[model samples]
Target: MTRRLVATGLVVGLLIVLLIRTGIEQANLNRFDRDMGVILTAMKDEIIRAEGGGVALDSFVTQLPGWQQQLETIPPPTNSGYRANLLQSVLQFTVEYGKMADTQPDQARTAEMVENLTQAIAGWDEQLRNGPGEAGHSH
Candidate 1:
């Protein structure tokens, strides 16, 4: 029964392809997670250091565009809305921080900006730990 053998071969081939695709997707997801963690943490730390007068905002401002580009370039895992949302939040953070640096906001406003950025970072971290639509996730 050559027909039967060919049918079985086709199924096996398709299963192999599926497995390879799944593995590739998993790898991509892992890379995205690792890279985003570092990027986001660095951003939060830089802002906190600047707010506390531990470091100048000049360096952080200089690095914002690169961070933004990296965020935009990293491809999220398939069907992962949380990862997509997290990237957007981080990108927005960079934009807001850049604007603040340009305008030299008042001390009170700086505090407010830091608070908002902290909350956003915390929320994204929680989502990354928990899943896309978890209780603590706002977006």
Candidate 2:
């Protein structure tokens, strides 16, 4: 009877530990989702304002390293394909905006960049829906 009690206690303890770990992981994923949403909204707003020269694409680029650093600080599963997609979108926006600001200097290019960014975001969303891990993860 004592042996059975010990085994049951051990099983219960292990189950509790697993539950706690899962909860923490879920919380981290939630935080990642919230942060990504905020960043995407800001990007969309900037693209919209680019038509009036109100958006500073260079400024956005300059801030990206800091954002990337923040992402790196998050624990694993937080830096998944969604984060990669955000980085790609930001890079694409910067390059396209720079080109438009230089040669075209018009709303057409700004619109194109916005569409590209949107498509990139959508692609990333699809990837996440199809897989739970990072797209580049080898394991």
Candidate 3:
């Protein structure tokens, strides 16, 4: 029957579309994971390097806006989970560091800022390894 054939074709088409969408989403997630790993590790390294007294808060103040924009582009699921929280902390630290850089440009407060961001970055890295364990993971 033509009706039966049409129904099956519709179902097959829908399934293919679903598969394509899922594949695209998976690719996006993979890229996001890789980018975040690099970003977090770099941030932590900069923080750790602050001990040697060469980590310039002014450079961070300029650099963080781009990082913040990248963080904003991360999709949901993990975005709403611990990853989002950690990103918020990073953004907050960026703003605070910028403000602090305006006044004293000292190492003590910069080190403290780095410590806070280091903790957030560590938590984010752990969350990434664990995968998106939250409720809104799309198939």
Candidate 4:
């Protein structure tokens, strides 16, 4: 009887620990989703507004550093595939942006930036399709 009681207590304790761990993970995922949403929305808005104007493009370029800083704050993914995809998207966009900056300065640069932005957005869409959970944790 004593052995059975001890076994039951051990099982109950492990169950409680599992439940607590799951809850904490869920909370972290929620926070990650919120942060990613905020950053992505801001980036989309800026890109849309910068589609034509030189001033807008300049402003958008100026904002890139801040966006990068925010992105860096995102926690490492629990899943390797998701993390790799996210990193790939970020790197591809950065390279495309650099290409735009190196090209001749004009509305042409703005157009290139817009095109690269579109590609980057598509990369993000692909990431969403390949993301880990039903809840779509972004960070």
Candidate 5:
């Protein structure tokens, strides 16, 4: 019957649209994950270098601006509160680093900051994997 055919066509059209939307979302998610991984890894590396003392600490001063920019520019999913929270942690670290980098904080103080940053990164990563819940803040 004509009515049956029309109904089937509408359902099929909607199913195709749904599939396309899901694919697009998955692609976006993949890109976000890749970008975040690169930026976060760079950040953690710099923090580790700073903790090592000497030239590595000095390098962080130069590298941090780029790291911050990368994080700022990365396109997080528009609807994700968890991504925003993770980014907030990164922002806090950058702000803290800016404050302390100026004074050239002592090694012990730098170490303390590094530890806090590492812990915050871990917490955020966990939140990202397990869904948003009470993320621990370092700053």
Candidate 6:
């Protein structure tokens, strides 16, 4: 009887440990989702500011460094290869924008940039909802 009791207790203990670990993982993922939403919104706002004019563009430029910092704070989960790429794209965008903003890329080019950014954001959102799969890139 004592042996049976000990086995039961061990099983229960293991189940509890598993449950706690799963809960922790889920909480981290939820936190990641919420944080990513905030970052994406900020990215959109930057593009909108660029769409506005010089003052808004200046504001956008000022905000981007903060955005980059915020992004770096949240390292992508090891399970998320696609997410890592999306984050890289965002960082690259900020760097590219800094270069382009200096020379002031033409309005048409600016619009194209915004469009591509929008597509990338949408693609990542889809990936998060569904599952990670191939999203082709170019040279």
RMSD per model, one decimal: 3.3, 5.5, 4.1, 4.3, 4.1, 4.5
Clashing pairs in 5: none
Candidate 6 Cα misplacement greater than 4 A, ranges: 52-55, 99-109, 129-139
Candidate 5 residue lDDT tens string, 98-127: 667777656424667667767766665666
Q: What is the TM-score (0 to 1) of candidate 6? A: 0.71
The models' CA-based lDDT, in order, is 0.72, 0.56, 0.64, 0.66, 0.70, 0.68
TM-score of each: 0.76, 0.57, 0.66, 0.73, 0.78, 0.71
Mark the 10 consecutive residues where model 3 has the least summed lDDT. 75-84
- lDDT winner between 1 and 3, please give it: 1
Clashing pairs in 3: none
Best-to-worst lDDT order: 1, 5, 6, 4, 3, 2
Model 3 agreement with the true structure over 1-139: per-residue lDDT tens digits: 9999999999999999999988886777677667777777776666666545544544555566777777676654352355455556556765665666666666434566667656766766777767545634332
Once model 1 is optimally superposed onto the true structure by TM-score, how far is the C-alpha of residue 116 displaced, in angstroms? 2.1
Where model 2 places Cα greater than 4 Å from the true spot, the runs are: 51-110, 122-139
lDDT of 2 by residue, 28-97 (tens): 7677666655655665555445434435644444445555555454444543555555545555555655
TM-score for candidate 4, please give it: 0.73
For 1-139, candidate 6 gives per-residue lDDT tens digits of 9999999999999999999988887777767667777887776676666665556556666676787788788767554566666667667776776677667745424556667656776666666555465555310
Error of 1 at 53 (Å): 4.4
Best by TM-score: 5
lDDT of 2: 0.56
Candidate 5 stretches greater than 4 Å from native: 103-109, 128-139
